[model samples]
Target chain A: MSVLFFELAMTAYLVVAVLFMVYLAGRSETLTRACQVGTVVGFLFHSLALGQQWIAGGGFPVTNQFEAASFFSWTLVLVFLVIDVRYKSHVLGAFVVPLAFLSVLSAAFLRGNVQTIDPGLRGLGLTLHTSLILLGATAFCLSFAAGIMYLIQMRLLKSKHFNALYHHLPPLNACDWLIGRGVLVGFPLTTLGILSGAVGAKFVWGSYWDFSPKQNLSALIWAYYLVMLVGRYTLGIRAKRAAYMAVLGFVAVALSFVGLDALMGETRHF
Target chain B: MNLIVVGLSHKTAPVEVRERLAFKATQLGEVCRQVTDQSAADEVMILSTCNRVEVYAVAPNVDDGFATVSAFLSRCADGMDVKALGPHLYHYPGNDAIGHMFRVASSLDSMVLGEPQILGQFKDAFEAALNAKSTGMVLNKIAKKAISVAKRVRTETKIAENAVSISYAAVELARKVFADLHHQRVMLLGAGEMAELALRHLISAGVREVVLSTRTTENAHKLAEALCAEGGPPVRVVPFADYAAILPEVDIVLCSTGAPDYVIGPKQVSAALRARGHRPMFLIDISVPRNIDPATAHVGDAYVYDIDDLQSVVEANLEERQAEARKAMVIIDEEVDTTARWIRSLEVVPTITALKGHAEAIARGEVERVLNRLPNLGEKERKLIEGLGPAIINKLLHNPLSSLRKEAQERGGRDMVETTRKLFALPDEGAAGDAPAGGDDE
Candidate 1:
């Protein structure tokens, strides 16, 4: 469809993301619910607009950086919605929305015009890798948010300043449990994403192990969370400790996905 | 007149000291008799609860009554002077005492404020005094009025409606945040009554998992069994030394132990948080000596509610209940005044009796003399004169009886009744017969 319409929808998602973050900080359930509604609405429009672009291109819309990025962000929101249904915590939406919104916005700004889908890049492995990574990233973002909330709550308790804001946050135990589960789900999917990316690399570049920065960084993120989970189960590391580690792992994952991708200059080196 | 409560509560006196002065159900009669015999109190009642022992009485000479009760207490306390316990005793007289009784009955003065047991205990004491026939008119009025006031307070206010105890309040706070306890896991640090009671509330609120950690294994097992029976998830006992081992599993931590210092601190909590990856933890420190150090709460993402924090919630709840209680007090006051007025109307019996007696006497004397003078008159005519004497007395007393009743409804009607009785030279209640004699027969 029209680029302007898609950009406007993406902007609406951006505003919703910022609003939800504020809601999380303010601990306003009403605003959070509104954010959730806004997100669902924005995603519906984003999907419709993306579908139009796919029809115009005459294939799967994974041709350029813009289409791939938009698709990745779309997958993230879809994954976040599924998790939100399961966990029923508006808290996850607080983090996932920002990341998804930012990626969509990035796609809008970076890709000014919709172009033809590259026939060579349109493979099953690439689709699987991108979808897995998008979902994993969404779940990891939730863990990251939970970890941050947990740390902030812990500090408030430690300072002996039991104010209204302090009580609004979820308990450390709850945060830890949620983040652990989130990490449990996200970690494997991220590993799969890396594996499938390797498979997709062989399909495109004729190499299974290219040792790219994205690959190396994704492995590091996986290793970080793996240690966090193992430490909790075997050595009796608690929810609080697990949450901190998950947060650290998510940061690593983000660096590998977007931060490293940006540094690598539009996939030319890869 | 001054009112004094020369007694001890759970805080001031030990159980031994309290038991020594305790008024048992059987001894209540004897105690009432002894108190009345020793003092000029027209009204006396003893309120003896497990946590407190108090005697409420009304006297014309407040000082003398206090002195008499103090002397009685001093004598009963053996060689221990009443001065030893004088500071603990609170003295409020007349209006203040009335207010105190109102507050106490309303559960405002209770150690665990808003408990309903005290009001029932108060009622029992009142009933005991009534059975012993020790309560005077004023004391009877006050006791009954206090009960009605307490009823109003309980009914109108939500004071006694919720969990008011510190442990229970902490659990309530957690529930408010979480909404559902059935999926939550709770770790209890001690076998304290307060902590256990809190756990019981949590269990009832749908907490599925309960972990008990105490210094004693026996206590842990016992608590585990009790919790299981109370519908809590299968309670597991964690060793006191294994705080870290169980810390990860529990969603909520309730720390109330007899430790001299902090057992759970920031270092351990922080270590746990880091190991578990910044997970959320809810911690409640209810121990007086503070089992959990204040610093431990700072280890990022842990929400802590201490005793002082919980107290404010309780205080706010109490203030709300108290405001409602004040409204109820007005209702009680009206009820008391109406009851008192009815009691005061009893004094009118002698006046009514005297008026009837005077009218009857005049009718009888005049009729008997006239009957003798008309000895030759027919039996029917003599009977007619006798009947006329009865009619004359009834007609004469009707207006006055109605006026006396109207006066009885007025303030100081007791004085008016006395004046009317004296004008007719009526005897006091004892000489005139029982105050309510033959009134119930019809």
Candidate 2:
């Protein structure tokens, strides 16, 4: 029953995301308000459903592919909501909601048949590891959105396009500041997640660096983020280059989340 | 309703008259209040800027609201030569007035075509009027429509697509020359206004170093201090005569001195380029008397964008944004129609009330007749019949009543309502409520 509600809530969220995109494209303020209300309601239902599942499963809903993917989408929306509240920018929804929908859609289709939770895998370290990775992924997602905005703004400024979309976009200084802040917050969590994963591996498999495909890809993603941060400080990369690096970092993170699991023939975490 | 706009702009009125008529930023609220209190118009809004002073009002039963607003404005100017200023004061009634406002909000009417500042000014004016409670339904509709149009113009038109201002365009040109400005050094050759604006833009663009040189040490020091305080690197105020000496160090030089003759002559420029080893320099000549000699282009690796060249760039940018301005106007037109319709719907109230009144009156008269016929019957029976009669009348009228109530919420439905009332000859308020109807409310 709880799963049913969760699925229903997710469906609503997907619809609301589409509506929000339509609202932004049409530039309909009335529709934008409706989209906000719809998204908020969807978030509430999603939260309620997740709560029910947590109680039913006797753990946080971050166990397997279905739960983790769903949780990732949920966290992204939560972050988006926070940004929207702080910035009061309905424009963010145009970039954010689509990704949220895609995340949920992937969960629905790719992890439909994954086993719920394996009782043996339910430990504090594993939960913490999963949580850190998810949080880092969420931050990366936000940075990617901000990066896309930065790139668009750069292109517009280059081409001398100061149209409505350009005006709606926060200034270059503001975007850089936001992306930097996102990275600043996310970098430590990502570093901690990788370190803790190493520790978890040692406990589970009696080795810290076993060169698993996932671990290797995770390190590569970390290195990409490191380049972004270093370039920003040392080279003083401001707008376009910084944005591209952040975007590249997100892509690397996404690949690590999915690519290695596929290579290992491990559909358990889909 | 006739839409009217009567205003004085910098183009039409002298500084003395415009200043007199101008609603200073401080006095905006007070002016709005005075206009609303005195005007026979159903709505009023005053838009005053350094460049334009406008009074928009909707007159009751007047052919043109423009004359009324014009008279009001003339009175404000205290018997100045209104005719001389009147020619400059363009008047647009009805649709023209609406279109004029749309253009203004979209920045089509601004001194600088496609500049974004007027939109903010318009918003400020509307907010001020709202705060003063001077705006009525007409002004409210116009203000909102103006905003919608401005937004649409920004989105759909090519207007505002480019950097039209010399300062912003200079920054763009700088970017093209140098991929990044983070480490670039900028030099100012004079303490002119144009130079200051351009320098400010460059500093905001993250230019690291700024060196100031002007005829006066006081002016140069002042500019340097201001720039340094704004987070840019500490500025160096070089002596005007030492520009030839300091010219070798900077990557970009912005020149706008007021000298009668060419300040940076061919000999001076060539020698400086030689000393600098021709490592590519960007010079922007914004002075009318032309600070940099025209022959200086012969110097290798130096790219110059003069004032006229910058003006052409601005013109091209303006053309692009002009297309957007039209698109925005179309959107505003649609909003205006929508708002007008909504306002028209206010007419439905009278129609609905009249319809309800007629039904109540008939119901009451019939109940009275029934009571008279049943005078010999018991009081309980009489009360029941009376109660039953109202219920039947209410049920019968429910659909029409609900529809009229709904219509009242729609735009332009009010006229339809008044027509219905006049056709049905509904009685006045006192007669309508005198029906022998039973108690319906708790």
Candidate 3:
């Protein structure tokens, strides 16, 4: 039942992504509302799917690549819902929802890779640690999407030619505010999650810092964000430059979160 | 139903003729009632705007319908020459009238193509007719469909997406550049007519602060007073010599001076850009000889759109709207066909009723005759026989009835209605028009 719900949500998200893309090109209000409905329905089923897994197995599901991918994509949907509802910019979904679709589809590809739930992943601390990290990933994706929007809008503003998207997309100041809000919340959550993960690791493996591939990658992601925040705070890096840095930082974080897991085969990484 | 439209619009009549024929809005309800009482049209509506004066009606007879509306218009414009107005009058009957309604509602017939004001005017006319009890089922249905068709044309086409006028184009460009214009400040260069016009648009858009400068301060004050009553944006007058000094604090610059030489230069724009932190600024130079240096646009975030540029934008927008208007016409054609089908389908209802009535009467008589000849028929079976007779008759008639309805939905469905009435041997009273009327006959 959980898998069925997951697949249904994945299909809905796929349709939503396509709908949003078409809506951007067509600038149809009907299609825009349909996209919002699709996103909400997909989110509802995704929540049910994740809830069913925890109810059936008695714990949070992040034991394998499939679970990890699905869980992260669900978090991304939650973030999109918040942004879409709060900002009321249908144009933002056109840029951000494709990433959600890709992540969920990639989870579908990793279907056979579902390993048994590791005992180390069952504790409350481990669940909290991973959930916080997923939330942070959600914030980073939003920031990254806003950054891309900012750059495109800037380029269009510089050139004096515009499409419908240019008219509908939020102004550069709004994009910067979104990124700033993302960093403000995401930085602290990521920091605490990493620290909590270290504590959970010590409790399970008798070590606080292992310098494993995952740890190293996570540290690199954290350091890059730290430098960006510091630059924003101290050096007064605002608007376009800050937007570019956000895109770059999010790329590194995505690589660390998704790519590092496959490279480190024997090293247990979440 | 015979729907007729007798009207004169900007396409056919001059403004002088239109003004002479238009109805007063305050007396619209009374005039609408008069038309309903005077004409053979069962339902009546009068649409009178600045560009057109039209009367739409659903009439029992098209000839009387046109005569009544024409006489009403002619009588209303008592002092005008009927001979001069005769050439400008346009009368359409039946489906052609419906198509005209669709076109007018969709802004195809508007002087400024795809303008939204006509639909609102139509709604007002519809409401006036409704208040006068002059619109019945046919006109009511058509009015609703006309509104929906207009809405579809707006959303489904790009007809109203871009601005078509120079001042409106400037305002639209400002909207594209700034997320919120309510907080922005505007500086007006010289009090040319175009400058005042652009200022009106800006002020209406919620521009809070406006610095108006001209060689004549009194003219600036007059323009400012015309724009604001009280407790609005303070339109302060600036000396023409110091207008350039205040450029750094303003977000938009509207230059429409008569000066042949450039009033704003690249150096000044560069200084303003630095003070404004390189923020986006719109410079609309609507002057004929051009008041701003073209090189001023070279500065980062300083957008210079001259009069010719704005006119070119308007032309491009007009071209786009023309293309979308073609698409809208296609939509309107489909709607017109749908509406025509709906009108034709109304004919089938009475025919089907008469057919069912005739068949049921025959079935009842045959069942009574059978019951009367039976010797020892049980009471329950006799009752069952009586009920089964009408059931069988209805079942047998269902196929032909539904087929007639389906034919009524198709092209040339009017012929199908006529043929059905003749073949079924049903009474032909109200089988064609079917508009509601009080009579001794059902």
Looking at model 3, residue B207 earns an lDDT score of 88
- Relative to the true structure, candidate 3 reaches a TM of 0.75
Q: Tell me how each candidate scores on DockQ against the true complex.
A: 0.11, 0.03, 0.14
Residues B216-321, candidate 1, lDDT per residue (tens digit)?
8789998788667766477889888896677877768888889999888887776765565544567888889888888765556566778897887777556655
Residue ranges of candidate 3 with Cα displaced over 4 Å: A1-19, A29-70, A101-133, A194-236, A255-270, B16-44, B63-84, B126-162, B211-215, B234-249, B259-279, B288-304, B307-442
lDDT of the candidates, in the order given: 0.71, 0.72, 0.82
lDDT of 2 at A135: 90
lDDT of 1: 0.71
| Top lDDT prediction, candidate number | 3
Better of 1 and 2 by lDDT: 2
Stretches off by above 4 angstroms in model 2 are A1-35, A116-118, A163-165, A223-241, A267-270, B1-193, B199-219, B222-442
| Superposed Cα deviation of residue B360, candidate 2 (Å) | 27
**Candidate 3 residue-wise lDDT, A3-110, digit = tens:** 899989988988999888777675446788899899999999999998997788677877566777788888888878887888787778887778888888888888
Q: What's each prediction's clash count?
A: 39, 17, 0
Span of ten consecutive residues with least summed lDDT in model 2 chain A: A21-30
Residue-pair clash count for candidate 1: 39
